[model samples]
Target: MDYYDTIILEYHNTILDWVIADKTTPIENLSVLDKGISDHSVITLEKQKPVKRTIACRNLKGLDDRNFASDIKKEAKNIKQLDTGAMLGAFNSNLRAILDNHAHLRTRTVTHRPSAPRMNEQIKEAKQERRKAERTWRKSGLMVHRDIFKTCTFKVKKN
Candidate 1:
């Protein structure tokens, strides 16, 4: 009927079965009423449950392909070493759940945000400049920041 009606409909479309994602979030927190009714009057919240994501390895924090391969190997070995099928299945499912967190680390990365206007043109230009500087630094064997050397895929030439 009104703007509130459309908003409630949109929410209903995404959240089927009236399930709240966060368990700690109380329904009463949303006490704001429009006119005399609520914006979420149509939303029937059943229960809120928190989501927890587990990472594969905490010790290995590098982007090198070797690290990824090793981490995967370590995880696989751990899974293989499990005595029971149920233990293996549980570990395997947990591994699959955190698939998004796993990534192949690239050598080139933007260290800082562009201090200029955040539009497409400015962002592109800034990225280009940063990349160029990194390339030059790599070729010339000149380190930009000493601490950044600790990151993935960086090898230092012993002088």
Candidate 2:
């Protein structure tokens, strides 16, 4: 009976939608909302928990190093006929394919993240102003706009 809100169903004098939790539960801002579609109200609460992020990365532990080296050597011999830029492209593509076959990528979630306090409203506005100035300079191709863009960039960096 921790909920202080009024009953959800006025006619029935009861709360049909509700949450039952122990006192140790880490939640706040619990409330009942009326969405107009259903007679029972919607229960909502905010959990006090850190954010989590997932990132993909190669699993180097399972890599076949010997086969990777041999594949690179074989691909390099076939790229001798290409120009410098094409040779670089072939080398990159071959290397990526070899790595993919050896160390396949895996995604994992990261937890207990710290919020970014430095990237506040002021810093965000400065970065946005810098981008706007850059776009205007590029479109106008004028010296004044270019100077303004440079100044904006300097201001953003200083902050």
Candidate 3:
């Protein structure tokens, strides 16, 4: 893959941004963006890495609650204990064993997309606003647009 080391000349005319990736993961279209709002330019890159992950899912298509309860009852009858804690522990373990027997775990491979775990609806909308403001600021180069972009950036950082 061809990588572009383009720098944003408007921001101090120095390489203030970077996108580092491992040898296995090729970084494509690496460029520094001039948003005309922040002190440092934004670094953007497209890393084409097809991630395949196996996820274990329980199959409960034919599972019935009444059958599950009867199985639990049978398992409970076998557990002869005096201590309340030990009885509870045995109950939980037996419950898990019965569940596993009823609904076995099936592994399936799927492609995964990386995302920010902390990001929610509000943060996502704030980021969208920040990007829109950034585009407007870069296009018009006006103080008002820059101020709005800075406000949006601050909101995003605060979250």
Candidate 4:
């Protein structure tokens, strides 16, 4: 059996490369991933079991202090009216309502912002916009435009 597998890793014709893989090691499954680096080919390896987590939140949007307090008291009364044998039983009776009332309790939506923009992105965008406008002004070649070179310059200090 040949250990080396030659594969042409071409991406949008922009990248034309080859990857020689040593297939001696056991690989459950190999699939080309949709995401990858500029010139590198990506493959997915199925190994670990997927994990799911449940988070509790409160959806108290548009409720003032007075109304919020009243809503809470009403939910508590509803739970008490369940007449279940135990606390857990009562919770199970109105589980959906309970979860709904507490959905907005935690500020995960506001606090847990995923993949936020970096400082470099803002600086780059500003620089690009400035450069584009400068180009347009130069192409018109009508009115004398002031030098816009120093408007969007950012100096990065290395850590």
Q: Report model 1's TM-score to 2 decimal places.
A: 0.21
Off by over 4 Å in 3: 1-48, 114-159
Please write out the lDDT profile of model 2 over residues 80-135, one tens digit for every residue.
84488888988898888888888887799999654464667887999999999999
Sliding window of 10 residues with minimal summed lDDT for model 3 = 1-10
lDDT of 3 by residue, 1-159 (tens): 333444333435653454544345567687776787977777777878688999999978779989998998899899999999999999898888898989987899999765545778999999999999999999999999999999999999998
Candidate 1 lDDT score relative to the true structure: 0.45
Against the reference, the lDDT scores of all candidates come to 0.45, 0.77, 0.81, 0.53
- lDDT tens string, model 4, 1-159? 344666554656576555554444444465665455545657565543334455656555644667555665675676644445775676555555544554545533233322423445756667676677578667875444324433433322220
Which prediction has the highest TM-score against the true structure? 3
TM-score of each: 0.21, 0.39, 0.39, 0.27
Look at candidate 4 and give me any clashing residue pairs.
57-102, 57-103, 57-104, 58-102, 58-103, 58-104, 58-105, 59-104
Per lDDT, what order, best first? 3, 2, 4, 1
Global CA lDDT of candidate 2, please?
Answer: 0.77
* Residue 10, model 3, lDDT: 47
Q: List the residue pairs that clash in candidate 3.
A: none
Compare candidates 1 and 2 on TM-score and give the better one. Answer: 2
Candidate 2 accuracy as TM-score? 0.39
How does candidate 4 fare on TM-score?
Answer: 0.27
Clash tally, candidates in order: 1, 0, 0, 8
**Candidate 1 on 85-146: residue-level lDDT in tens?**
87778667756544434643234323432233324564565555556656666777756532
